[model samples]
Target: MSGQLFVIGLGPGNASQVTPEASHAVAEAEFFFGYGPYVDRLELRPDQTRIASDNREELSRANAALQRAAEGAKVAVVSGGDPGVFAMAAAVCEAIEKGPVEWRDIDLTIIPGVTAMLAVAARIGAPLGHDFCTISLSDNLKPWAVIERRLEAAASAGFVIALYNPISKARPWQLGSAFEILRRHLPGDTPVIFGRAAGRPDERIEIVKLEQADPAKADMATCVMIGSPETSIVERAHKPPLVYTPRFSTESSQ
Candidate 1:
């Protein structure tokens, strides 16, 4: 009797953003495995055990969780945002693929949660209202040239771009380089949003133009959204501006 493995997304820092399904899954889990901060988010009963590892150790964490599950323990692996979005879900699947045959026998359930891009988009207006694509700026798994090429391709295609893992202490220059690439493809006046820790107590959302965007505004916690050429902003009296991309494109008018 192989045990069950639940891959859960805890959502962006806010408790309210956590889905009920995820909550239920957490309750049913006897063992939890995840990054330290993400696992700490859960209010597990004393009986439940948490095994936390470094955020960068995704594969190792997945293997450990699978090993426990194969031992007939109901285990849960948690991610801060959507587990499927550059998170633990993929790692677990990869582990199962290369792991022992018994690892594949464990029943797996994936519970979704609000990701950073969605949370950030909701904070302002609908910057993602139109065509959009997300790209992670972290070059840890991929090469920097690959990231730059994708940024250029996404920008040239006029897709609203949401960047994850935008800037970290270790890789500070990449975000600035990304902005330079965007400036070549996007308009100087295009809206760029820097949403940090969306839905959390220390949340900060800043909107700027492409030319004015400073890389210093972002950190590892920030989700950077660069609007398409078709995106627009609506100004309000004594209120923050609302930014949105029109639903209909110029080609649609034809």
Candidate 2:
């Protein structure tokens, strides 16, 4: 009998945020494969085996899961947040595309979860109520030039931007460079949010103006969100401030 491969998204870090389908998929799998930290989060059954690897070994991890499925082991390749959103789903699909014809016979399912951007938006307000785009500031897989172009284009288009993989020890300067590009098109007082480790114990949400959004406040665990021109803030007495983009567009009103 042919075995199955489930690419599951663990959501942020909170177990409650995970979808029922994704949880079921994790429970059903006989073998789990993922980056070590993500794999460590799962509540594995006694009958299950885990294949954990370093964060950068996505392709190899996907391949190993595929190999296990081909050998009749039900496998789950897990990712943090939504697997399809800058995670293992794409890597698994790419592996299947490049593998042998027999690889096509494996049952593959992509289980979605609450992506970090959306979770962060929910915790703050609906900053993404209007048009928006997501970008990864990491240049590990793509060139910095390509990332720069996308950042400039997004800023020019006035799209509320959600930045993933914003900064790390090796890529410390990219977030600063991206902010500089945004400053060229956006006002200095525009709203920006630094949502770090959302849903985790150390989770923090910092709201600041673009001028105050220092890249030093971010790390690999942070998701930086920049508001579009249409975005606005509403303050309440004894309540945290709310930031949101208006649903209606001025273009339609004209």
Q: Taking the tens digit of each residue's C-alpha lDDT, what string does model 2 give over 1-254?
A: 66999999999999899999998898899999998989999988799998899999989888889988999988999999999999999999999999877888999999999999988999899999999999999898999999999999999888999999999998789999999999999998889999988998999999999988899999888899999988898898999999999998774433
List the candidate 1 regions with Cα displacement exceeding 4 Å: 251-254
- Weakest lDDT window of 10 consecutive positions for candidate 2: 245-254
lDDT measured at residue 186 in model 1 versus the true structure, 0 to 100: 87
TM-scores, all candidates, are: 0.98, 0.98
lDDT for position 119 in model 2: 86
Instruction: Give candidate 1's TM-score.
Output: 0.98
lDDT of 1 by residue, 42-138 (tens): 8989999999999999999999999999999999999999999999999999999999998888999999999999999999999999999999999
Question: For residue 42, what is the lDDT in candidate 2?
Answer: 91
